[model samples]
Each structure stands twice: as C-alpha cells, then as structure tokens.
Target: MRFATYELDGSVHAGVVSDDGLHTLPSGTTVLDLVRAGLPAALTAGSAALTGPPTPLDLARLLPPLTPPTIRDFVAFEEHVEGVVASVSGGSGVPAEWYEAPTFYFTNPYALIGAHDDVPVPPGSRLLDFELEVAAVVGRDGSSLTPAQASDAIFGYTVFNDWSARDLQRREMKVGLGPAKGKDSATTLGPWLVTADELAPFHDEDGFLALDMRVSVNGVEVGHDLLSNMGWPFAELVSYASRGTWVRAGDVLGSGTCGNGGCLAELWGRRGEQDPPALRPGDVVEMTVEGIGTIRNRVVPGIELPPVRAARSRTRAR
Candidate 1:
C-alpha cells in the first residue's frame, strides 16, 4: 500500500493512500511511527482501524514520507558516473574502485522538502540540476547483515530528487572531500511511499527493481532511465551501508541516479550546453518512477548570504 504524511488543519498525520484519498492511520501519529511499529504490517493493521471520511489528496498538503533519522545516498550506477566524469575537464572514465563496492555519502536530514514544495535556486549555482532516483526506507534496525538479510530490513520505496548545485559541488570536490554545502542545501523525497510488498512484482531476476525513472524540467524531458540499470542492487547497498555500522529504522538509502541520462550533468557531457539548459528560478521539475508516482516542484530564488572568502592558514609562516 502507498503511505504518506500529510497536513490537515496544521497538523501532520500518517495515512494510507486509497482510490478516494488519504485514510488516516489510527495506529500511528506519523509515518515514522508506522515504520517503527513494523512497516507494512503495522500500516495494514492501522489502516484497518481508520474511520471517518478520507481526505482527497488534492485538498491536503503532502509532506515528505517522514523526516528520516539519517540519509545515505549512494553512487550505484556506472554509466551515470562515467558521463558525469567525462563532462569535466581533465576527467576520464569511472574510477576502478567504484566497481568494488557501493559508496555513499551522508546528506543533511534537516534540508528535506516534500513534493510540490518550492526549491530554492541555490545562489551562485548556474549549473543547478536534479537527479532522479529511488530510495528505500529502512524498516528495522540491523548491523553487518548480508545482502539477503538486508533485503528484509527494507520498509518501502519513494521517488528521490537529489537537487544539486553543480558549481559548488565542483569547487568542493576539487578539495578531495565529499559534497557539503553543494548538496546539504536541499533534497526532495515524496509524493508517497510505496511499501515493499506492493513493489515485489517489479523485481527482476537479479533482484533489482525494473522500474522506469524519468525527469522533466518546465515540462521538457531532461532525463529518463530504468532503475534496473544500477550496477549494485538496493539490498547490496543496504548491506554495504551496514558494514561496521548500524542501519536503524527511519534511515533512508537512495539508489543513486539511474543510468540512461538520469541527471543533467550526464546530458551536458552528451549534448553540450544549449539544447536543454540548466535549471533556473521558476522552472518546475517533475520526477516520476513507474510505481512511485510523481513529485513536482517549482524552483524559487535562494536566500542570499555573506560572500565566502578563503580562510587564512595559521600553521604556515606568513
């Protein structure tokens, strides 16, 4: 079943999506509560206790499925990496180590936005871009689990749009560290979350979900691909993340960006600059996953701040 967190009369509540609208979940206060209570099982049981009229989705405000306890986004697609790398000067093919394991970076959990929310067009980011991906929300707590074991820990899936400030990202990446301000500003997740059982049919022989992923800006298609194109499966990504660490309930692990042009950085490498330009203020971005529905957001101007300056080195002689 599809689950969502919505606002009604200024109060947020967890509910199950239905043909008519959202049915309030009596067993939980928020989607996180339902997740902690055992995901699909708890969701089903709580939905059964629902009474009163269902709220039509159009009339309610949708929020992110839940404010995740932690967010880990992985680079699990090779083609995406290759294309992004090829776009930059002095860059070559995908790094050899990328093929060895699924790598991820922890992003700011506080910077999340829900579907239809206005995303600030990050200041100084001329290359603003959106990454179309899918994310799995953790259902149970586990550590060092095998891929098979990790599979059971997954609660469900949701459409994830990893909004990027490419200019900031490039500047920071040149320092040999991970993305910080470049990505920490904002990330979008939702429309609604789909429980694992509901997506079982979409799984392929290799265990990867064969879901179609697409992204459009201002109603123009920018990227499109299949989730099955990932080099590592979501279960493996979860298991790898659990290595020497614990993955708790409410933790979200993203499938990274999909292969066949899942981001504008890739498109730039293939098609160059003019054809489909970078995201700008007022541009609407819509991302869709075959089963997960769509999330449409309008880009808003970012809040300005003091200029950044280079820090003085205290350790070196003047």
Candidate 2:
C-alpha cells in the first residue's frame, strides 16, 4: 500500500493510494493506524472511502507527508562521495570517520516540493544539480535499534531529489557545519510513500528487484544507475541513524545519491566557471528510479529575492 499527504479544498490530508483511487485517511494521521489495525482493517477503511466518488487528485500531488518534522538525510553511498570528491577542486573527502556511521543533515521543512511541483532556481545557485536517492519513511518510533531490528521499523519508500546549490554548499560545508544553503534551500521528495512490503523485493539481491534509475534534462539522458548499486543497505542505515536519535513515524531518511553518474557533478566530471550545468528557465529535469515511478520538474528563474541579510545569515549557519 502507498500513502500520500495531499491538498484538497485548501487543507492537507493523508490518504492511501489504491488502484481504485486514493482513499482518504485522517488528517495528521499515519499508516501506523492502518498497520496496527492490521492490513485488513486498513484496506477495508481505505477501500470503503472509494465508494463516494472521491475527489480525483493528481497522484503526483504534494502535501507535507509529516505536517512538519525533523528530516534527516543520510550520506550512505561511497560511490557518490568518491564522485563528488573527484569532481571538486580538491575532491570531497574528510577523515575516515565521515563514513563510520550513517551521516545526515537537517533540511528546512518548508523547502519540500511535492512530486509534481516546480523547483524554483535558487538564488545565486548557478550550479544547481539533482541527486537521485530513495528515502525511508519511518513507521515505528525508536531511539536506537540494531540493523536487523531497524528493518522492521520502516513504513515505506519514496524517490527523493536532494537538490544542491554547489557553489554555496562548497563554501559552507568546508567550515564543518552540516550542509546549509547548499542543501537547505530546496529538497524535492515524494510522488507517494510506498509501504515497506511493496518495497521489500528491492532488499533481497536473490530476488534483486530491478530498480533502474535515470535522470534527464531537456529530454537528454545525463545520469543513470541501478538501485542495486547502493553501498550500504537501508536496514543498516536506519539502525545507525536511530541509534543516537529519535526517529518517529513519518520522519524521512534518505539513501544519499546512488552511483554511476548520479549527479551532474559526477556526470560531467570536474566543472569550471566556463562549463556549469546550472538549471535555467524553461529547462526541464526528470528522474525515475525503477520501481519508484518518475518525478519531472521544470526550472524557472526566481523573480523576487529574499532579504539579502537574512539569506546570507541562514546560509552561514547551514
């Protein structure tokens, strides 16, 4: 089963996605309710709602999956790190400790654009790039757990674009602060939250659910990778992430960028001022990660800018 937070009549509500249609769940609700009630009860309630000629919302709608919660994204892929490091002036590595456990950064809750929304060209972000990742939607609450246990706490998966403003991020992350403007300003996630069961096939290499991923700009294929290329598995990440922090239902955890040309920084190799693949007005970027459908976004320049001081201050803290 897939769950979605969506807008209808100016309000946000949760719903279960069914082939019949989207069945509304309670506002500020969770899949836990359904899971606890057992799949039968959850499906019954969701199925019953489809009878009244429910409002037909675009499946690719956006509503805060969690009205507002702390979002933690993990840098679990080594290939991405190597790619990023090799592309930068000096390359992107630190002490080996950087890889000791799952590493994550906090993102502004409001920067989230649903699966279908347009990603505004961020201010002063000439090097805007997209990352292809799969994020976990926490279903069970736990402060810490072992890797095997962590696997059971998840509710589902969704595709994520950890959009980046390279130039600004580079300047800030170098100072040892968790990602700031480079990542904070905009991170697009969600077409729908797919339940853990639906995502299970991807877990077993024996079954090896073929999750092919691809990113395209102006209809040109620039990046592609298989989900099987992930370095660390999801269960380990959740276990590591939960060990030192409270992760509750609805909280989001990202599987950092995947390998094989996952981002522009890697696809094009090192970039100089002379050649940057910065997104501009009218340029469209679309991505699809095998089982997880596709998210297409168009880039348009921002007409108005926020106060320079505040923007500068926020970027500094990030």
Candidate 3:
C-alpha cells in the first residue's frame, strides 16, 4: 500500500492511494501516524475516511510524507564511497572501518521539503548538487537489533534527494570534522511512501530489494543504478544505526547516494577533474526509484544567512 501526506481543502491528511483516488484517514493523522500504528493492518481496517473522488495526484500538494522524527543517512554503496574518497582524499581506498559497519551522520530534520517544492541554493554555495537516494522510515522503537530483526522495523520506502553544497562541504571536511553547514541546508523526501510488503516481489537472492534508481537534472539523465548493488544492505544499515540508541518510529534512514554516477562529485572524479555542472536557479531535479515514485524539485536562490564561522571564532576566543 502507498501512503502519503497531502494537502486537500487547505488541510494536511494522511491516506492510501487507491485506483479511484486518495483515501484519507482522520483529520490531523499523518503518514508517520500510519507507520507508527503499523501499515497493512492499519490500512486494511478501513478506519481512515476516504476523501471525495480520488484526488488527482497533480492536484494534491505533497509534503515530506511526514517530517521525520529523526534522520540518519548511511553510505552503504561501496562504489559511491570509493568515488567520494578518491575525489576528496586524493587516492585513499575505502576506509577499513566502513567495511566493519555502516557509517552514517544525522542531518537536520527541519530542512525537509516535499515533492515539487522549491530548493533554495544555499548562500555562498556555487557548486550545488543533489545526491540521488532511497530512504526507509522506521515503524517502531528498537535498539541493538541484529540485521534480520532490524529488517522488520522498516515501515516503508521512498525516494530521497540529499541536496548538497559541494564547495561548502569540501571546506569543512578539511578541518577534519565533517559536513555541517555544507549539508544542513535542505533534503527532499517524497512523492509517496511505498509499504515494504509491496516490494516482496522484487527481492533478490540475498533478500535485498532489486529496484532501479535514476536521476535527471533539467530533463537530462545524469545517473542510473540498481539498488541491489549496495555493498551493505538496508537491514545492516538499520541494525548499525540502532546500536546503543533507540530507533524510533518516524526515524528516516537514507541509502545515501547510489553508485553509477549518483552525484556530480563522482562524475567529476571519473572525468579527470573536469568541472562538473552545478545546479542553478530554475533547474529541475527529478529522482525516481522503481518501486517508489518520482520527487521533482526546482532550485531557487536563497539569501545568505549570517556567517557561522565568525560566531564560532568569537566563542573560541572567550
């Protein structure tokens, strides 16, 4: 079943997408509510009220499914890791620790945007880019789970675009910490959420979903890859993420960027340092995963916020 958080009659409602149209649940209940309540059964119970005629998708203004309770993005694709390291670190191979477990970072959850929303290019970032990815929403609170058990916690899947400020990110990484101001701008996560049960038909021998992912910028295809190629499966990433901390319902775990030229950094590395194109105002980014649908966003220029560096410098002196 596909669940969505959409706007109708100026109110946001959660519901399942049926052949006829949008079947809405109670007012104020959200997509996150259904996932927290559990899918399939919650949806099959016929409790949520079906809104008027099937609301045409185009007419329904979408949100980010629901503003996640928390967001963790992992680098589960080896090709992507290798390309990123090569581009930034010059010649280092994949980090040894990455092979031991899934490595990830928590991002600002408040910066989320929905399908067809406008993404403002961060101030001071000339090299803005998008990371094409897939994300899983957690259904229940859990901790210290084995990979197999963690798989059950996944509520569903959706397309994710982790918007990036390459120039800002590169500058921060030089300080030996990580992407902070560089990445805290905006992340997109919608179109619709597809329940995990809907993807049983696409599981591979290893039980990993074999969905295809593609990305286009301004109608030009830039990347394509099969999700089955991920070096670390979603279960392992979730298991790793839940270690020592609670993975609550509505938590989002992104698949990071896919391989096969998922981001411009990888493209630039492979192309011998040729300047890769940066997203400019009015550029449309459309990312699609086979099981989930597409999330299309337009880039808009945003004004600069005050310099964080100057503020930190003053604190350091005191």
Candidate 4:
C-alpha cells in the first residue's frame, strides 16, 4: 500500500493512497506513527479502519511522507564512485576500502523538503547538482542486525534527491571533513511511500530491488539506471548502518547516486566537458523510481551571507 502525508483544507493529514482517493487516517496520526506501529499492524489497520470519506487525491498538496529521525546516505554504487573520483581528482578507481564495506555519511534530516517544493541554490554556490537516488524508511528499531534482518525491518521506499552544491562540496572536502554546508541545504523525499510488500515483484534473488530509475531536468532526460546496479544492496547498507549502532523507526537510508550521469559531475568526468549546464534558478528536476513515484522540484535563488573570516597567524614564544 502507498502512504502519504498531505495538506487539505489548511490541515495536514496522513493517509493511505487508493485508486479512488486518499483514505485519511485518524486525526494527528502521521506516516511516521504508522511506520512505528510496524508494517503488519499498519496493513491490518488499513483504510478500512477510517471513518471519514476519502479525500480527493488531486485536491491535497503532498508533503514529505515523514520527517525522518535521521538520514544516512550511502555511496553504494561502484560506477558512481569511479566517475566522481575521476571528476574531482582525475582518479580512475574506487577507493580500496570502499570495496570492504558499504560507506555512508549523515545528512541533516531537518533540511528535507516535499517532492514538489522549490529548492534554493545554496548561498555562494554557482554549480548546483541533483543526485537521483532511492531511500528506504526503517519500520522498526534494530542494532547489530544481519543483512536479512535489516531487509525485514524496512517499512517502505521513496524517491530521494540529494541536492548538492558541487563547488561548496569540493572546497569543504579539501579540509578532509565534509560535504556539510554543501549538502545540508536541501534533500527531497516523496510523492508517497510504497510499502516493502508492494515491491515484492521487483526483488531479485539476492533481495536487491531491480527497479528502473531515471532523472530528468526541465523536460530532457539526463540519467538512467537500475537500482540493482549498486555495489551493495539496500539490505547491506542498512545492516552496515546498524553496525554497533542503531537504526530506528523513521530513520531513512538512501541508495546514494546512481551511475551513468546520475549527477553532472559524473557526466562531466565521462565526457571531459562541463556541458549540459549546471542547475540554475527556475530549472526543474524530476526523479522517478519504478514502483515508488516521481518527485519534481524547481530551483530558486538563495539568501547569501558574508564569507567567514580567515584565521589569524599564531605568534611563536621565545
């Protein structure tokens, strides 16, 4: 079943998506609340339990399915790693350690926006980019889980756009620390969340989702790939995320960027040119994942701030 958080008649609501319309859950019940109750319980307590008439889907404004407790984005695609490494450093291979395990970075959960929201080009940024990816929402709490267990803990999936400021990211990572301010600006999720069971037809023998993924800018197509192309599957990414740590309900795990033009950097690296242009104000980006849905966002101007002051030189003690 598909679940979504939407606004109707000036009020926000969580509901189950059906062909007829959106069946609103009880007042104050959110997608996160349903996820926390476990998928089985949610399915059993489906829209049949609701009393009110269905809300016309077209009349409601969609919001991010839920405010994730945390967002962990993993670079699980080998081709993406190779292309990005080449783009930044002219390097030709993936890091050796990257092959040893699934790696990820924490991104700001508070910076999330809904599927149709406008994204501001982060302040001081000239080269803006969009990453086409998919994310899994955790349904239960678990620690030190095995890959199989992590698979079972998943609640649903959503289209994710890890919006980036390439210039800011390049400068920050030079100090060996972040994609911090470069990335914290915006992350998009939604349209709706499709339950794990709903995607059973797409699952491969190794439990990887063979869903087709695609991204387009304005009206032109830029990148396309299969979700199963990742070096590590979603289950392993979640399992590694829980290594000596915890993954709880409402936490989101992203599949990172797909390869073959997932982002402009990868394209530039492959073609050795900065053609196709970086995102500009008024540019619209749409990412679609088969089985889940599409998320389209437009870029807008950002508020600029003064640059940080340079550090002063230290005096030597005689």
Note the Cα lDDT for every prediction shown. Answer: 0.86, 0.70, 0.83, 0.89
Residue-wise lDDT of candidate 2 within 1-318, one digit each (tens)? Answer: 666777776776778666656677755566545544544555576666555444565633665344336677877667777667655435555338656766777777678887777877778777788888888776678888887677777766788888888777777777878678888766777777777777676666543334788888899887777766665677777787787777776678888887776787765443423233667778888888766667778877865666455343355554
lDDT of 3 by residue, 145-234 (tens): 888888988888889899989889888888888778788999998888888888879888896889999998889899999998887778
Q: Model 4 over residues 90-186: C-alpha lDDT tens digits?
A: 6788899989988889999989899899998888899899999999999999999999999999999999999989888888888888779889999
Best by TM-score: 4
Please give the ranking of all candidate structures by lDDT, highest first, separated by commas.
4, 1, 3, 2
Task: List clash counts for every candidate, in order.
Answer: 0, 3, 1, 0
What TM-score against the true fold does each predicted structure earn? 0.95, 0.83, 0.93, 0.96
lDDT tens readout by residue for model 1, 1-318: 888998888888888888889888774477887788786566665568455578989988899989899999998989888877766433778999998888899999999899989999787777788899899999999999999999999999999989988888888888889888778878899998899988999999999999999888888887888999999888999999999989999899998988766888877766656346777888999998998899999988888877787887697766
CA deviation > 4 Å runs, candidate 1 = 49-51, 88-90, 272-275, 315-318
Candidates ranked, most accurate by TM-score first: 4, 1, 3, 2
Q: Please give me the total number of clashing residue pairs in predicted model 2.
A: 3
RMSD of 4: 1.5
Tell me the lDDT of candidate 1.
0.86
Off by over 4 Å in 2: 26-44, 50-60, 92-95, 205-210, 270-276, 303-318
